[model samples]
Target: MWSGPRNLSTAMMYSFAGRGDCAVWDEPFYAAYLKATGIAHPMADQVISAGIADPARVANACLGAIPDGKPLFYQKHMTLHMIAGFDRSFMAGLTNVFLIRHPARVIASYSKKREAPTLADIGFVQQAELFDQVADRLGAAPLVVDSADIRATPRETLGRLCAALGIPFAEGMLRWPAGPKPYDGPWAPHWYNAVHASTGFDEPEGPLPTLPDAYRALSDRALSYYERLAALRL
Candidate 1:
């Protein structure tokens, strides 16, 4: 999933990986690099660094690391992590799909969690720019889900997403047993609460994920970037 932050990318992953035929890998590259090297990311002070330590090295390792399975293989990836010296040739062959939601909600959700680099905190416009680059290269317009859409029409929206990706839809993709996956090491506390709450892809409740007051202006800029892409989809 690609966005400034807090766009429910991992939850989306959990949704897809729930399917019977999917061999889901969560943030595999991060751990591989961490095990291979001990270098710190720029935000190492705030975020725990794990996986393959070097971005380029991590990309190389991913070339053949995707799981082999009868079902689909689900890779829940972060765009910022992918472009850090990633192997474009390998990525070019991927069934690459972008997942996005409003920047305000994303940043707000991060703020609510007290996470760093909230959309406003990390320069959301730049992150959205990066997301655009990824979508263009993939030639597939992003899945472009809104938080509201997930809350309102999860099965229908996800069914459309699966159809677009040429995967057979299944009820299993609606939800899964939550808590920790093998590959989810550091992100559990910060991002897993909502994911764990799912008893099977229930519709979103309450309001959409929110943005921080501090990042509202940046969220506007970020949303502009998203709006441009949305124009194409429309």
Candidate 2:
């Protein structure tokens, strides 16, 4: 699954990992992206040290055999991490699903974690680009699932997603033991506290959060890209 930060990507990863048949990977390209861009993040040094900084090696590993010989590999990817110079060829060999939230929500949530996010920092533009790349490669649009829909009606939403991916929906996907998993990246402490405290998807969100004017403007810039994929969501 491809998504921006502050989306429900981690919860979704936990959901899939709850299915015993699947092996989950969390943000494989993050270190490589940080190393290449030299961007300072909350845990930049530790994340780079703990992760594979070589994009080529990361790509190769992504296409390698599933860990533990599992029947399914669910890789949780951050679209923004696929910056320039990273190879996207491995993506063609796997199912690509885009997970999106409203830009206003993304901005509001993301700003709390990393202040003053730009368009690139939130991953909407990169997500759209990746979606188009996959769609063009397959001669059709790949699967798109909204975080809101997943929160509101997880069983039905995930059931549809599983069917599209040619997999059976396991009831286990709806819940998991609260706390971080072994697969979480080193940066989890910085970004995953809320998810770690949850056992499953939360109730459907209330009205969108109010944002400062600067953030509201940022959301406006990302809205089009989000809407493009959202319109095609399962």
Candidate 3:
């Protein structure tokens, strides 16, 4: 369960799901859950209009298939999607990995689409806190990984991730035939970039896109919490 937005979340999904031995469920709760609840999300209008409204059924489907040939399942999740009645207990039986990116980069990518939402509403602070809460209760502090590290030192970082999850790192996890997946199918044009064009992990030294003033301000403010979580201190 990697919780984040536009933070290589989709790419990471392909990386894990692409493996011959793993099964991937991309934000399974999104479409049905959003439709049934009609919950006002950050971009509630856009979200509900397009995806699932009943998330429980998705959960049921994943759990039901677990005993079969499903050795490992990588489920993509949105931090803000943890609305009322969305029971997270499904996490109890699975390994949890929390994916995080600097809020600046996240919002910058998000701002590219319709009705650009705010940091406060994106649920960054609350998500980070809830990640800790869920991880603590589940008896495993999630192996949180930085998106920058995943891009910069992918081999070593992914190797570490696989180790924490008790799996052997495979070369396929590091490289795939570039471009989108079934999930990336719908969002291709709106958020896709040449960066997302390739399937393998590439060096991230290129100039990132320019951001809005609101994003910079909110990112600077929200970063304090992320700093505490990902940084090592005495």
Candidate 4:
């Protein structure tokens, strides 16, 4: 699956990991992205040191057969992590799923950790571009899931996703153990605190926060892209 940061990607990872037939990988390309771009994320040094920095190698691994002989390899990817030079051809080998959230909510939640986040940092534009590329290659619309829909009805939405992916729906996907998971990336401490605290999808909070004037345009752009994909969501 491909998604932006803070979009329940980790929670989805936990969900898939609960399945006996699936093995999960968390942001395998993130370390390569940080190394190539020199972006100073919260734990840049630690993450890079722990991962293989070559994008080619990482892409190959993503395209390789499932690891550990599992029937499914669920790779959680971040759209922004695909820097300008990263190869995208490997995407044809996998079933791509886009996870989106309201841009205003994404911006508001993201700003609490990183200030002055640009549209690139939020990743909606990159996500839309990737969605187009994958759709063009496959000659069919890919699956999309809104985070709000997952919160409201995880079982139904996830079942639809499983059906789209040609997999069986397991009730075990609805909840998971709390705290750190073995498949979490090293940077989880900085980004996954909220998800780690939960055993399942939390109830939808009220309305989204209003974006400040400084981010109004950026949020609007993101929302346009989000709505485009959301229209095709399951």
Candidate 5:
């Protein structure tokens, strides 16, 4: 699945990790992204040093074989982390799923830790690009799951997602043990504190994130892309 930051991607990763038949990978492309862009994200250097730094190598790892010989490999990826130079052919054999959330909620949640985020930083345009690419290559629109829909009805949403991917809906996907697992990315400490604290999807909370004046334009642009994809959601 591909998603932007603060989009409940980690929780979704945990959900999939709960399944015995699936092996989960967390942001395999991140180290390569950090190395190429030199964006000073939290723990950027550590993340790059801790994992495979070459995008091609990482792509090969993701595409070549299923590590541990699992039948299904659930890779949790960040759209922005794919970066400009990365080969997208790895996606051809993969069941690409796009996970989306409201722009206001995303911006509000993201800005709490980072300052003055741009549209590129939040990843909606990249997501739309990837979505279009996958759809064009496969001659079919890929699956899209809205975070709100997942939080509202996890079983139904996940069941539909599993059916689309041609997998059984495992009861284990509804919850998992709290705290980090073996598959967590090196940057987990910086990005996954809240998710690491939860065993299951938390009920959607709050008065939706309040969009600041500076983020309004970016949010508007993101909402356009988000709605376009959301219109096709299962």
Candidate 6:
């Protein structure tokens, strides 16, 4: 699963983790991205220390055997983390799914966690690029599902997604035990409170949150990229 932050990604991770047959990995390339870019994030030092900083090793691990000999491996990836130097050749071997939320919602929720996000920080452009890459390689558009659709109708939305991926939709994915999971990355404490406090997808969002002018502008810029994938969502 590929997504930007605050886009229900953790909840979706938990959803997949709830399926006993699937093994989940949280943001495997994060440490490598941070190490390569030197951008400061909340808990940057601890994240780098706890994670593998070598992108090559991370890529290899991504293609390696599924942990615990599980039938399915669900890797939760941050689109922005695949920065310039990281090779994307590994993605061709995996089933790439893009998860999208409205940019206004993303900016409003993300700004509260870490202030003043830029275009790259929010990842709309990167996600669209990645989608195109996968589509070109496969000769078809890859799978995409909107966070809003998931929130509004999880069973139907995820059922369609599971069918596309050639997997059965397990009922267990609809809910999970509240609180943190053993598989969360080191940076979870800084960013996963809302998801950790929940047992399942939250209520469908109300009207898009009102943003200040600067953030509104950023959201406007991101909307086109979001719409492109959204139009193709399952």
Q: After superposition, how far is residue 51 of candidate 2 from its true place, in Å?
A: 0.5
Lowest summed lDDT over 10 consecutive residues: which window, candidate 3? 183-192
Per-candidate TM vs. native?
A: 0.76, 0.99, 0.82, 0.97, 0.96, 0.99
**Candidate 4 pairs with clashing backbones:** none
97: Cα error in model 5, Å: 0.8
After best superposition, candidate 5 residue 231: deviation in angstroms? Answer: 0.3
Candidate 3 to truth, TM: 0.82
**Candidate 2 Cα deviation (angstroms), residue 53:** 0.4
**Which segments of candidate 3 are over 4 A away from where they belong?**
36-52, 120-123, 183-189, 192-196, 205-210, 232-234
lDDT of each: 0.58, 0.94, 0.68, 0.89, 0.89, 0.95
Between 2 and 3, whose TM-score is larger?
Answer: 2
lDDT of 4 by residue, 29-93 (tens): 98999999887788899999998799999999998878889999999999998878888988888
lDDT tens digits by residue: candidate 1, 37-81: 444433342233444555566456555555753346677665545
For model 6, the stretches where C-alpha displacement exceeds 4 angstroms are none
Tell me the tens digit of each residue's lDDT in model 6 across 146-231. 99999999999999999999999999999999888899999989899999899988889999999999999999999999999999
TM-score of 4: 0.97
Q: Which is better, 5 or 6, measured by TM-score?
A: 6
Indicate the worst ten consecutive residues by lDDT in candidate 4: 203-212
Worst 10 residues of 6 by lDDT: 84-93
Best by lDDT: 6
Please estimate how well model 1 matches the true structure, expressed as its whole-model Cα lDDT.
Answer: 0.58
